[model samples]
Target chain A: MPHISLPDHLPGITGLLEFSQNTAAPIRELTQILLRGDNSLTQGERELIATVVSHNNECRFCTSAHTAAADLLLGESETCEMVKYDLDNAPVSDKMKALLTIAKMVQKSGKSVSPEAITNAKAQGATDIEIHDTVLIAALFCLYNRYVDGLASVTPDDSSFYQYLGERIVNHGYTRLPQGYDHLKNS
Target chain B: MAYIKLPDNAAGMRGLMAFRPHLAPHLGAFTEGILCIEDGLTKAEREIIGTLVSKLNDCQLCEGVHGAVAACYLDDNEVLIEQIKEDYKKAPISDKLKALLNIATSVQKGGKYVSESQIQRARDLGATDIEIHDTVIIAATFCFFNRYLDGLGIDPIQDSEIFRQRGRMIAKGLGYAPKK
Candidate 1:
């Protein structure tokens, strides 16, 4: 399925990361900043964008993982769908929707995100940092989607994988998998 | 015409970077665990993933910055990089990396956008979980960074060589133990 061999059958850059050490630190740093670093957007909001983009990209492993994580931060079902389907129309605060709108534009085209988008986001009380982080989040997801789809990595067979992983990731944070994660080799 | 005031930008990106020198201090150390693998992927590969993702997103700033960064490990073939930006599948890359780019694409769009069959396809091709995990994070994070550049209205530098030089320094670590 993947274009190449992988460590746990997941595709894309993850497989490549396994056998090498020189590149890990930078990659890890980048990932941490993307998911965990403090920014204008909350972790849930950030992960929610990932879920939306993952869904758009049809990257299941990522979708399930982030969706489950979104559930933890937002809630199950309704809020999750809100994050997945309609951030602009979701029940989130106006500032959030404005930020999400700007984020979507970042996904669509950096140029398409008009001045109004930034203005509206700012009027809704989005800070320069918030606006900046929103665009960053969206732009980063585009790169991520390409990476996974480009490599054609394998996703976990279980839908619950993300849910379980989300809990662990949310509690412990990204980069650190649950204990005995290496046992996934047995899966 | 600009979303943010013009005078503020040059100072903003610099000021922000100056303040948050630890862009990913914790994440860098935490994610190193999966650095182990059989296929021999390196940090450069992940950076390429981010760079390619940024390119696809069309953020001239990020594309220029990360593109230059990605070029550090790769041979200095501008056409090849251009080909990758235009279309990775048609570009010159190993079968292994091509698959990773697919996964990264999924991550860029959003995790839910990735389908079950896609995962199966990658696995069928022999993708591993660590690779998958790292790809997800990379994709997810690039989205963050892509937005950061675009949202802040950071203009792409005309001289890409500067970003490339920065990438070289990054390849060797922050050096000063993160001033932040």
Candidate 2:
């Protein structure tokens, strides 16, 4: 039972997005550009950043959704779990470890991110754009995490739903759901 | 003294947005949609929510910028913006706004900190679903903005008058989106 009457069919952020289409439009666009758009960072790497931040925030729905997406894009579930639980020892490159450290700091508090972290990331070959995108992705997921959980939106108990969502995210990217989903609004 | 080489002319979030032009429009549009659009929450109330979150997050730039915008809309009630920032619960405002601000505070701490009793209280005070939804979104979005600006160590504008002038322009419909 969400605080607001959201649709039953769409769970988590999807339902909240549908309920508020105006805000949802730009939000979807932002997510698509940050996650799926061409960049120096691979889509998998970006999803990893999102997963790590969501995990730090303890947002169950977001952590599950992005973890699944990351697993698919990276072609393994092990790495996502590794990044979530033990990022320091995760089998990623040194650059990714440094970047994830910054992401974790951002998740804690903006002030928590020290100048040393930025220096370390740069030394590990993380470019300015990569650093910029990493922080933006982390910050964006914070917004998503709070939005999804603040409303007490429904989180599907079924793991299969996350698998389907992971595929859709990897294949279709973030966009508005197809038509007839309008019937689900406020339902 | 930003960690990155953000544009020198623009300060705070503006500098960061200018640093990444391709992503700026979407971020701007989203800000416009949530804060500028007249929904169940008035633009003043929405800005108030954003200001409160920024203040709590200790992002002086966002707190000052949005607080000025909120004050611009509040006009004679401009002082009330500070009151809300200091303590919304004790401030003279509708019970509905008080309830919504409480929710915003919890969200500033963390998403899971928002309680069921808070939502129920807002509902009892006649807050619509959209109002509650907008309140949470505004609070959440500020968390993003605050971190983005602060995480990179963007410098805040020292002059309060600058924020007031910008706030008036925004209040007069110069929305968050950069002009095409």
Candidate 3:
């Protein structure tokens, strides 16, 4: 069914890291900084950017997962749906809407983000850092959306799964797959 | 009136734990390591790659927040960020950054989008192998991060202050604390 079918459970990037201890530390460190760390964005905002982009790519697993996470963070069902599909309709601050618009532009066309969108977001107080971060998040998500979709990993169709993962991710971090969750054997 | 209502990621994180688990710490370190280079690309240029890619991907979460991250380093200069965000090629940045971003853009589209010529151009502009490698990695990793976040559909934190503080923190080297 998938374009490039991997095993039900593949070793993924984790195994590659383990192959070389020296390489692994630096890889892990970089991963953490990109995902978490301080930026002009919150963890939630970053997640939202991923969700929106994935939605465009139509990566079901990513869409569902991030939607669940979005619901968890903002606490609004209609809003989540709106943000998932048409964020313009979603009730958000003007600045945010403009920013979201710009993000979508980046996703759709890297070279198409309108100067007006930038101006609008900036007018609403979007900073250069915020703008840059937005573009970064959008660009990075494009890769993520492709990678997940490219590799036919098991995309669980369960909101509960996302909810569970979200809480832990927020509390702990994306350090390792959950305990007792081994994919190498299955792969 | 940004829609701020939903069940949130807390409820869905459990399912994610089973499949992907928690790897943020590692990813965090990964990003930092890739970004720690002294003089290849200015912090602004590096963040530009990150911001531009995220923008292309259409990840609202990444866009909303990272836009702020890009802004922080730019001294809230939305215009400059916009120039890059709108059109990196025409943006008021050095040719080197523009070329590197072109390479990064290729990665965002698919490595095939990156050709030997682009790499050569970057090298010609004085990009080190390490810098090139890190740039690719950054692009590649963000792709992962973007999908993971989208897979989860986490709500974006729409607070400017939060990201402003984040910019400061990130500019501060993300500090080193032993992992728990």
Residue-level lDDT of model 1, residues A1-187, one tens digit each, is 6544566643334454453334444654566676787675778888877777667656666677778888898765576687667665687788878877776676665666888888888899988766655665566656556555545566667766666778876887655343524555656
What global local distance difference test value does model 3 have?
0.59
Instruction: Estimate, for each residue in A6-94, the C-alpha lDDT of model 3 and write its tens digit.
Output: 33443333333332234346543443554577866666666677678778777676667666666666665566677777787777777
Sort the predicted structures by TM-score, highest score first: 2, 1, 3
Interface RMSD, candidates in the order listed: 6.2, 0.6, 9.7
Model 2 stretches astray by more than 4 angstroms: A180-187
Backbone clashes in model 3? 124
Candidate 3 per-residue C-alpha lDDT over B1-180 given as tens digits, one digit per residue, 9 for 90 to 100:
111122334322222233332433444555655554455666666677777877776655555555666676778876887788899888888888887788777777754356667877877998775466556656766565554444334445567676566566666555222235
Return whichever of 2 and 3 wins on DockQ.
2
Report the C-alpha lDDT of model 1 over B1-180, residue by residue, as the tens digit: 335544444432443454344653533343333222224456656667777877766667667655665666566555666778788889877766777788778666555456666666657776676576566666656565556556566666777677766656654554212334
DockQ of 1: 0.23
Q: Kindly list the per-residue Cα lDDT of model 2 for residues A98-143, writing each as its tens digit.
A: 9999999999878888999999999999999899989889989889
**Alpha-carbon TM-score of each model against the true structure:** 0.64, 0.97, 0.48
Of candidate 2 chain A, the 10-residue stretch with the lowest lDDT total is A178-187
Question: Alpha-carbon error at B153 in model 3, in Å?
Answer: 28
Worst 10 residues of 3 chain B by lDDT: B1-10
Q: Candidate 1: global Cα-lDDT?
A: 0.63
